[model samples]
Target: MEALTLTTPALLFSAVSLILLAYTNRFLGYASLVRQLYEKLKANPDQVLLDQIMNLRKRLYLIKNMQLLGVASLMFCVLSMFLIYIEVFLPAAYAFGLGLLLLIISLLLSGWEIKISVRALDLHLNDMEHFSEDNS
Candidate 1:
């Protein structure tokens, strides 16, 4: 097998950084939505609003996990590079492989969270359609 170079894991740094940024953006968006929902709940409590809050709670957990895994992946990549610098190729390769595995899990979590978000939006659209039918 070919030896793993420092550059091998170094390439993952940029990709992981971008994924972390995207996760942060999603977190901020959820924070804003939660604040809005909190106020709405205080003004007038309703089942639909409560359901949305529950859904947001689940998505927030998913985003948090994704951010954590992405950071671990980034950390491992750095660790692997340092190992490679010290001429420890075997251990470095193992660390790099772990980093890649973590990144894959993070991406999978992100995709799952997105699917939940879309389903939430679909519920709202269905409500709107029902309202339109009632009006007609």
Candidate 2:
């Protein structure tokens, strides 16, 4: 019987794989929320609700991109891990580094998305103010 020795890159790849999968699930949940918001807006396109719809749409786009990136990164990590196990192809360090880069890219997209969503909500708030004034 031989004991298997896992390299640092292999360990990192496994960690990234798990993290990316979790992120994908979280993004999917966000997508579902956006879908629900869209359905609600379809029923009633009031000024406030319309604003929320717009905000949710922006968030949805961001989440979609994030999910796509996470999936890509996860796939690459899995492939890299398999290659490492087989002891063929490039170094494990390269694989781990690339995976980390992809995760960072996704995180950056998520941050930008949060900023855009906040701006959208602010715009909706202004619309609400205008609607109230018009009613008064």
Candidate 3:
């Protein structure tokens, strides 16, 4: 195999940075929503609200894990670059491969989270449809 170079691992920097940025934005949005729901629950908790809260809790955990894996991916990429700088080509390649795998895992988790989000929204739409039908 050809020797690993710092540029090879550096290619991941922008992609990883963008991913982390998006994850951070998602986390912040969830945090705000949770606080709003918490206040509402404090005043008057209902079954629907309770269910939403539970859903949000699961989403938050998933986001946390996604972020964790994303950061780990970034860390490994940096480590790989450093190893390459020191002429440790074999270890650098291994580290780069691990970093890529972790990135893939993070993306998969993101996709799962999106699927759950869509399902949650579908429940709301279904409920709205039922309410309209009952009125008719």
lDDT (0 to 1) per candidate: 0.97, 0.70, 0.92
lDDT by residue (tens digit), candidate 1, 5-82: 878888999899999999999999999999999999999999999999999999999999999999999999999999
Q: For model 2, what is the C-alpha lDDT against the true structure?
A: 0.70
Q: What would the TM-scores of all predictions be?
A: 0.97, 0.63, 0.94
User: What is the model-wide C-alpha lDDT for candidate 3?
Assistant: 0.92
Q: Which runs in model 1 stand beyond 4 Å of their true positions?
A: none
* Candidate 2 root-mean-square deviation in Å: 5.3
Q: How many residue pairs clash in each candidate?
A: 0, 0, 0
- Global fold similarity of model 1 (TM-score): 0.97
Most accurate candidate by TM-score: 1
Quote the positional error of residue 88 for candidate 3 in Å.
Answer: 0.7
Q: Write the residue-wise lDDT of candidate 3 on 4-123 in tens digits.
A: 778888989779999999999999998999999999999998998899888998889999999999999999999999998888888889999999999999999999999988888899
